[model samples]
Target chain A: MNEKTVAVLKQAFKEFYFKNAEKIITPIRMKEREFGYMSFDKVMVRHLSFQTEGDLRAFLIKEMPHSVYYSCAYYYEPTFAMDEKGWKGADLIFDIDADDIPTRCKEEHDHWICKDCNFMDKGKRPDKCPKCEGMRIDEKNWVCPLCLKATKDEAIKLMDFLLKDFGITKENIEVYFSGGRGYHVTVERSALEELDQLARSEISDYVSGIGLNLESLGISKRASYEKMQRMLPLANDSGWRGRIAKFFSEMEFECYNSNDVKDKMIYIYRKMKHKNFENFVGEVIGKLSTKIDAMVTTDIHRIFRLPNTLHGSTGMLKRRCDDLLSFDPFIDAVALGEEPMQIFVDHSPKFTLMGKIFGPYKSERVKLPLMAAVYLIGKGLAEVD
Target chain B: MGIEFGLEDLAKYPFMKEAGDYVKKLSLRVEDLGQEDYRPAVERAKQRVMEAIQKNYISIEISEPIVELLSFPLALMLVKAMNVEYIIHRYSLAEAIRAESLLKEEKKSIISYIFKSTFNLEPISVKHELFDLKIKLIEYLKRATHFHEPEWKLINRVVDNGFVYLKTHELVRLIREEIRRTIYDRMKGVSLPSMPKNLKEAVHEISRVLPPRSDKFQRVTPDKFPPCIIYTLDLIKKGQNLSHYGRFLLTTYLLSIGKSVDDIIDIYPRSPDFNERMTRYQVEHIAGMRGGRRRYKVPSCRTLATHGLCFKDKILCAKIRSPFQFGKKPLFKKKSTGQIRE
Candidate 1:
């Protein structure tokens, strides 16, 4: 970003932090957590510790950083180097992002530009530039209602797993809108807090259904329909067996007998070719499993975006969602004002914000709401007029 | 504390916490073992260590309860004085095996007491259709993470309301792991006092009988490769269409053991649809030279099993976590220079 855009974003963020410093809630065990932030100049300053919520608020009011983060882990010495710090435990966190989930709306709103050849196109970015064969491809992803809805569904699926399979109580789970195209579910003060990285990886795999085997559920490839019906997992079975059996029941197959849900599913499976059966199994797994960022859950020392803090890319607050179904990120997470400001839009996709639609602009100067102007300016798609 | 075991029970499983309390109550100093009165206990201690190293199982000969109780601590002291890593591991395993056998006949309350007082684990007795005892999920995970079998995975187990249901034998196995770790930890970091003449002679004899440490990691040749790698290599050489995971396994295994990118590329020419550019790019990527700049490691033995690629040689692959760990000892007798040949 240019100096002007940075200055504009910094000023807006400073004013917001100065007025709403109390809205940023203090995390549990503030003294034992590591705090970090990215300055306006993009230099990350980390390994910082705060003793109280007052200290954290004072630091935010003074520094006015572009983004703020806190560690997921608790350490004995929060300000020490990575290896020197005694790691006590970490909260089990999962990040369900719209970027990882596939939605058809991305083809309409997302685009990629090759830095080397100046070629721009829509849809997902390829690994290498098709025109220039260069590796420097810059992608511009814009969130839409469809993509955001996909992420919310994934978050719901994840919570279902946590509640049913892992048996974590609802009160221990906190869901947050990431201020930019994602949801982060954190499990705190639970039995999962002290799980090491390997065990956490297993939990991630279980929720995501990474290594699920049909044979483990007694669904063998060579078994006949009659044999499979006899050996099929019942709907009352626990864990994945129960889950797969319930999925089979909900699949709505034409049944000759009403009580034979297993028989109907087996009849369909017996008719499917070997390749089709694999695809059918894949579809079942896709519906049952969550699409969580495995790396985030597996990383013990990762820093996450602080709640109620502005995300630099979108100028929105990472707001906590009490009811995930009714929470709308574009409205609830908007932290900037509605004062009008003029900005020269280089290029941007049409987007919705706070119940208003903005233009798909091209090199035009327009007076937009301060929140939209800041968002466009932060994304490097607009400049101060 | 209300539940008490007899002296015979204490002697049979001397690593129990109550046995430790009994030994502390005796107040026997190290010098007391050198006297003629404690000669039988001292000799029994030496025999304990020797049996652990030679037979991998200590046969219980508890003719005298006091002597048996005293010998357990003495044996621990002797092991700690030697302070060799291999001996500590073997002795701990042997002791844990003995405890497992004795625990098989104990009552539920007794097993639960040992679980709490010894390992600090809380296993609640429950009446379930398939299981008798249930431990908290986190407690189960703390020990089960070291296990590589698919059945041991938390996803495959019977868990409800954060408790994992386990059978009596399974619970005994977890206790065995805890006992092994406790014994191993107790046998470390000891500064021995001046030994008596007879004790010194026992130490010298034990040292003479100690097995030589094997240097299995020294030679990295194709003949020493694990069965999975060898199977993948055979498939590649036979011009069979290998899966993506098979190719990844072969390439990473060869690259990790210091094989050059070009040499690995040469092994892939037998594939019917060989493309030099694509192969080079993939090899370079896995080797950490291109894209992400992070070298890929060979997946663990459990991962291989999940992927259905593990052609397990039960004896050769025993206790090995990764493909690189296989053939740590030579698979066959051979006489050649320890060098990688193309």
Candidate 2:
């Protein structure tokens, strides 16, 4: 990207924040929490704090950092030594990203070049280069509708689990689309504020379905025969046993296709012949569990991308997902300034953005919108002409 | 070690099942609970159970550990005269809520029987307890729903699946207040068989249900203390020998008023038998460090009176309920010579 392109993106970001200044907020007790950001040169800045939203807005407008972040933790003295900064409590947050959500398109349009071997290949990068076994693999990922849709599905699943199972209400939960590929879900309830690392780890396990004992839900050989009987005897029971039982009772009598039942909830109950019940439970759990970054959920001290800020990498707003089902990151999250900028496309896959299709332009000069140009250049797929 | 029993254990005890089923049906009919019509029958059963416990014959049935389960309804039977409707509802609801929380924590524990059974048994009760509770709470919410839609919706969803979910800490506080006003008041003076080890467990079952009360004042103005607390401070200044309970009340009061635990311990040296280590330990324990990790709630007016340490003017004693409620409104119009009297 040229200096002019970066300057335009910066101006666009400044306008975005200025327009949404009232919506911006630092963590509670802002002066007591450490903030971090990434500069345009990609240099890291840490140990930052703003006394007010106005102060933070002024700094963001002045520096126009690529990304902004604040600590999830409330510290005793933020600028003190790490251990010396007494950690009070933190908001429990879960991060789900498209990068973490594996899609076939990643293998189709994404390309990785090994800097060490100068070897190139399409699709997901291997840990080591296939030709020379070198570890330095630089990757280029193109955003597509299919992958974004997959990411949204993951987000929906997570929201459902949090609300229905975890008993977290919508008021306490805030879902925001990360300017990049994923979504961040934050639980801001005071009930969860004092949760230590271990307690938070338990929540992580529940959501991710890690180490859940099947026997606990009466889906094991060790489950007393009486429990198994109760599972069948009563039609109204509600745990996993009831869920499985309800699934069986609700099914049409003669579907006759084992393939149809294989992937259904009935499969777990159908396989419960006492001996292999545990295996069935495990399989069902694997299919139903929501994927999340367990580390992000468990960490008492974390920094997340600030909401309402423009993501430098995508030229998209890190907007809150009020309407997740209808939220299109391509169209809805595009940053301000629609003026097309001239750039020579290095290489890019055909992608639909802003309700229009553009792409697959190899070494061709193209005039793209300011936000689109920034995104292409950010992905290393284009440069200023 | 304590006769490892769960709600499922009630199946082995025929008599407990019979009594528990009776109590569950009786409890569900809230309108019929107010009359003393069913009191005689429950009292008779409670007497029979107490006689069995005193004779030590009930403990012999290791195969049927029904003592804990039986004691719950027995205690309720004893306190039935003290507002039966309130006690029965509070006892049943508390037990169900506690079961849900415990089952959520220790999923593999035998408490699953509590989630499975339809009867409200002794230790952990039946599966339908959650369903019953949901019906009652939802009706209460419909009559007087104070929360936002998200909170209400979450409670509805959790209850729909036959589970009760307390969405926010504030909601939990609201429930606890209801419990305190109902059950805690009724059972305050009711006597039960104290000899059976299971009696303590049964009575204390819902003890951990309340979250720790926070008395952290942003800025405590000690001069604004209620006449009673001020009287106690004056006693401390004069090196008076306050009783053990009196010392406990004072130490906790001072600590909650922003005094350091060490500072609280130091104030106790004037006492006749103050050993540094003992004083420190007692102080820390009251501060919720050495024993259960729960801070002490401020002693209410009635509790202070029970200790016979309540020194208050007629206005202070009649109007104030708690120490925290004293300085909350800034209505005191006294200029102090640092001396306060009842």
Candidate 3:
């Protein structure tokens, strides 16, 4: 971003923080959490400890950083260096980002440009550039309603795993719209806080269905068709067995004791266009498993974006969702003002903000609401006019 | 209500808190254990360590409760005094196994008492068709994390209302794991005063019979290892936690390069959660000596990248497709030097 765009974003962020300083919810054990922020220039300032919510609010009002973060982990001395800080424990957190989730809308909004050859293309970014075979590929990702809805669905699936499978109560689970293209589900002050990296990895694997063995669920490739039908897990069984069984039932194959029904189900499974039992199992796993960022959940020392702060990328508030089913990020997470502002748009796809649709403009100067202008500028698609 | 356990229970589970209370009531010091009155205890302690090392199981004989109870601590001291890592792990496992076998015959009340006193877990008894006991989910996870089987994953089990339902045998198995950890912790890092003459001789005798550490990996070239293997080895050497895939990569890479199972097992002692039996089973399974009887091949660089274990070198890694090809000389290289020329 240029200096002019940075100044505008800084001013808007400053206004938001100043007006809403008191609205920031204090994290549990605030004094034990490390605070950090990134300046508009992208210089990260970390190892900062605040004694109270008032101190944190005062710092925010003075600095008004582009983005703010607090550690998921609690520490004996929050300001100490990484290795020196005595780690108490961390809240179990899961991140479901639109970037990680594969959505059909990405082909319309996401594009990648190879830095080596300057070759640009739409759709998912290739592992390496086709023209130059270079690894430096810059991707431009825009979150559409479809992408956001996909991410929200993933977050809901993750919440299901946390609640029914892990047995975490609804009151202990807090879901938040991450203010930019994702959702964060945090389990706070629970018995899971003391889990180490390996344990947390196992939990991640369970939710994501990594390393799931078919034999454990009584679905074996080598079993005879009769035995396989007989050994199929019932829909009321526990855990993955029940999940897979329910998935099959939803596909119109009920696990009843009738010979005709069993024969029909086996016949359908066998005639799945050369997809063997393994492929069928794989399909079930893919559809039933929750897509979670395993790396973020397993990292105990990671710092998360603070709630109620403006995301630097979109200028949206990272606010909690009291009712996830009805929560709309574009409508509810908009914290910036509607004052008219003029900006020169280089190129941007059509998007919605605060329930109003804004254009797919080429190189043109247009007057827009403050929220839309700040969002476009923050995304590096616009500059101050 | 506090359940009362008798001398038989204390002698069988000498690591229990009640055993400590019994020993405290007797008020026997280190010096007194060396005296003639405690000769049988000293002898039994030597036998305990010897059985653990040579046979991998310590037999319980509660004919003499005092001797049995006293021998437990004496054996711990002897293992600590020897201060050998292999012996420490073996002895802890043997003692835990001994406790597990004895707990199998005890009633529910006794088993629950041991659970409460030793592991600080209060698993409530649940009347269910498949499961008889249910533990708090957190308590279950803390113990179950050590298990590598898919069945032990929390998602595979029956969990309801923050309690994990478990079979009696499964509960016993979890207790055995905790007992092993507790025994290992108790045996580690304690300096004992000079032992009695006979006890010192026993330690010396046991040391003579201890198996020599495997040195087969000395023939393998460490300098030629790929970056990912080198990184995993570094983590293992530093006693850090390695991911499952990281362990698999290191094991398969070593096995592919003709490292013996014993040599591979020796490499893992520095890991924080090393279990000799588990390591040996997994290593042998990979070597095609167990389960499925198909020797696994080293994963390709693409597979490594998918699992996020690839730590590729820009120049060297780009040349090889698989980690097995990492250190080998190029096929077209001349026989004189046998090295890839820049």
TM for every model, in the order presented, reads 0.78, 0.53, 0.82
| TM-score of candidate 2 to 2 decimals | 0.53
**Two-chain DockQ for each candidate model:** 0.32, 0.02, 0.41
Model 2, span A1-385: residue lDDT tens: 6786677667767777777777675555687678889987789887677778789888887888889988888888877767778898888799887777778888888889999978989988899999999998998877688887887887887776666555567888888888888888888754566666545655565556555454333344544544544423222443233433444445544554543322333344554564465565566555555678888887887888887777788877788888899999888877666686888888888876687788878889999877777788777787775
Q: Is candidate 1 or candidate 2 better by DockQ?
A: 1
Q: Write the per-residue lDDT of candidate 1 for residues A207-298, one digit (tens) a residue.
A: 88766666655567788776777666777766776787787776766544566667756666767865686578778888888999999998
How far out, in Å, is residue B161 in model 3?
A: 2.8
* Cα shift from native, residue A273, model 3 (Å): 14
How does candidate 2 score on lDDT?
0.60
Which pairs, if any, clash in model 2? Answer: B69-B122, B117-B126, B117-B127
Pick out the ten consecutive residues of candidate 1 chain B with the lowest summed lDDT: B212-221
Native interface contact recovery, all models? 0.42, 0.00, 0.52
Interface RMSD against the true structure, candidate 3: 2.2
List interface RMSDs for the candidates, in order. Answer: 2.0, 10.9, 2.2
- Using TM-score as the measure, the top candidate is 3
Off by over 4 Å in 2: A1-8, A18-32, A222-226, A231-277, B1-342
Per-residue CA lDDT of model 3 for B1-342, tens digit only, reads: 477788877899988878978888987767777688889998899999999998889997676988899899899999988988778878999999998888877777778878997889988888865677899878888888767566787766766667888877788888898898788887774568887777787789889888754444544578889999999999998999988888888999999877888668878988988886678768888888754678888899999999988899998887788988886766774368667779
Cα lDDT over the full model 1: 0.84
- Indicate which candidate wins on DockQ: 3
* Residue pairs of candidate 1 with colliding backbone atoms: none
For candidate 2, the chain B TM-score comes to 0.32
After aligning candidate 1 to the native by TM-score, how far in Å is the CA of B195 from where it should be?
A: 4.3
